[model samples]
Target: KFPGVPRVERVSFNKGPLELVRHTHMASLGDAAHFEVDYVDMPAGFNDPDLSLEGGISGLTHALEAQGARVLTKEKVVRGSCEGRDTTLFLPHPPRKEGFVEGRAFGSGQRYYFLMFVGEEDGPQLREMARTFMESFAVTDGCTAQPAPTPAPSSPTVVSVVEGTHDAATGWRKIENTELGFGVLMPGAARHESEQAQVEPFPITHHTYINEDDAGVYAAEVFGEYPPNFHNTPGSYETMLDVTLYAMKRNFEPSGFTITPLRDLKAGTFPGREFTVTNEKLGAQGRTQIYVTAKYIYVFTAFTRGQAAASAANALERFFSSVRITTK
Candidate 1:
């Protein structure tokens, strides 16, 4: 007689969590009770749980009854006994499937059976391995069952990162995730790698990046400066204005150029660099300008066309209108 674990009790480990154990007469074995579910409740807006369980178990009992099998339920535990010629094996309920079944294999003369019940705690983690092991017990007479099914592994999900700007008119948006920072986002309609590649007759050489849209055009220059010590001279007000205007003329010269100074005083002061609206051929016809106040120069030039120039100027008016300097 293959009597099961004699005594069942919960135990704790010094290194980790607690576990349950089952002791037997000959050699006691550990309890595989970690996945046992003590209780469960069906939430609203779900199918009827009771009816489903009844249907599945009823079908299983019917199948076994047809094969002249007797059903027995032990009220309380009994001492070991092996009197019956046909053996019956008691198994834990299948964790996942909502149905159960029993089958008789006449050729092999073996009876296959299984039980289905609502899952307990840790149901999900135990279901995959448990289901495969139970399914392999297919009505084998003297033959050994096939191996259990193995589950495929899974991987983690990934996320992307971006940066942006915020103001009263337009909200926040991320330009891009980059190593260079905000200046890299300056628009470019056409861009040249180094000052040497720029249009000829322009004495100052620079590495430039440019951007353009109806709002405005932006041209940035990284160049050598007057002091000969490039870094020291950069970030100064006047020097920055010169480099910015130079880059603007270079960009718009293919057409023509003119500048109109506004008598209306805007709230801010133009630093060493200045921004102005110039007659330039492109979207809208007014120019949006920028100045760099440093040993080296960086410029952003934007222009608008015809009536559109006014709108472009307004959009970028902040460039010159908002320019200011601090003593600190």
Candidate 2:
């Protein structure tokens, strides 16, 4: 007999025809946990006597009392009859499935069905589906204790993260070995604290050092304590690319630009490109070795002595062709 819902129509009270009547039978009680179901099957049709309805209700009340839930609290609910057949429909929102899944009792029979509203805020996506099931519910009439419906099995996929670390001794060592060392190859140094100022206001939890002097370093930080719910942020690879490209082109250059075609390599082989351009002003003719590998864009510069600029360009081509990118 919750104030919100006007009635409780047990389908068992209906005769041959499907009729739903909303009664004003209402009440407010203590915790709904203190309730029970009792069975009372009346003869078919609206011709059943008023006592049949009262008997059905009395039987349920008796069953409830027998179950020891009848704590005589001051709780009160409205009660009455429609085309009476034994039933205690209009009452406190009945104890529901979640509360009764283990099994329940009312008297010689058990009653199923409790009221609940899973609001949209609880989980917005499945609201319509849940409402569809709620609207289709039919009240039971002739009392017969029945087993509760089987619950829908949940299917959830779980991923586990295994924590560990890798040693750094395998890579080519470059720079001062003060833990500030840069491994030209891929092995990462042991984890240590970074001394540079974080580029952004967010606290930095992870970072990498290519040049310690540049303290203008690669910093990975986040505002919150948890990983972001969405991956809209860029990582080290993209950030480094942007910073490097910006530094190279901040000032105008004379030779313009030229990009060679990419050559695909077979397994165990390295894929890369080669290109050449000259700066007329610096007279600084240089040969550039271009090796595009998994971890980096290695562009090594070798200056041409005297007027060997054109020859150095050809040498640059061979250098790129000979260089290897290996994962072994």
Candidate 3:
């Protein structure tokens, strides 16, 4: 991917000046008239052989047909059981024409779908561009896909904070904060704390969950009113993220620090940014997600230290995956 955004690109794929763009919608492609690719990262334990790679390509073709397109050729390509299909689509009203070639591939525990279209007369070029883009496409190692969020149940009962050992019989316990309008699954008996602070003009409420024995900490901060000046429009989101990261770096003051590029992510239904930070000298690692909603901004963070950090990996993932924003 291209650092923070959910975009992947290759420098020189073809002579037609081929470009690849991935997103949820066509209009979102903007000037990317070359190719449109959409990729989804399946969650851990999603190994189902029945969901063949061909099925994925077929589904995309069906979707195009639903949008008033005619398929011309459909066949399998030799790339981890990949498949490619070509179609002709007519624009609404005056029937302006275009041709599309789509391809799908599943391998190395990930899924990818790409669609490229141009004028009907340029069908040959469009097919060549799609082939080259797919051939060069790759997902970087150690960069797993983020699975789709599971829908939370309605009217979930809020679990009260209990002291002493957690009930292992029940596994992880759910802790909900009605005030902050969010909930998370705690690893075990966790200490909870909350406080009010000023994040600029906004009054922010911070909540923390800590497992002392495991040396794992999960935290959430809710801001009532985000600064209007921090609005993330196009290139501005990076600036806001930089401000946040700078504050974090100063607060930690680590001997060695490394941070991943900010990536657009989702917390339940809320869109957000997810990133990782590590302090090798301190043996500390953290994953943080920040969401900006219409009325509030939410920041969720998880961190662990030392040897215990290794064992806490599963717990940390569970804690993050189980998070649900309860408020509308």
The whole-model lDDT of each prediction reads 0.33, 0.29, 0.51
Best by lDDT: 3
lDDT, model 2, position 178: 22
Query: lDDT by residue for model 3 over 27-135, one digit each (tens)?
Result: 2234323344555543332343223243444555555565666666655444433433333343222354454545454444444444444334335665565456556
Tens digits of per-residue lDDT for model 2 on 165-195? 3324433222212221112221122222333
What is the descending TM-score order? 3, 1, 2
Give the Å shift of residue 48 in candidate 3.
52
lDDT of 1 by residue, 201-241 (tens): 12234555444555555544455332332222112343334
lDDT of 3 at 86: 33
Clashing residue pairs for model 3: none
Q: Model 2, which residues run further than 4 Å from truth?
A: 1-243, 251-274, 287-294
What's model 1's TM-score? Answer: 0.30
With candidate 2 superimposed using the best TM-score fit, by how many Å does residue 100's alpha carbon deviate from the native? 60
Error of 2 at 144 (Å): 74
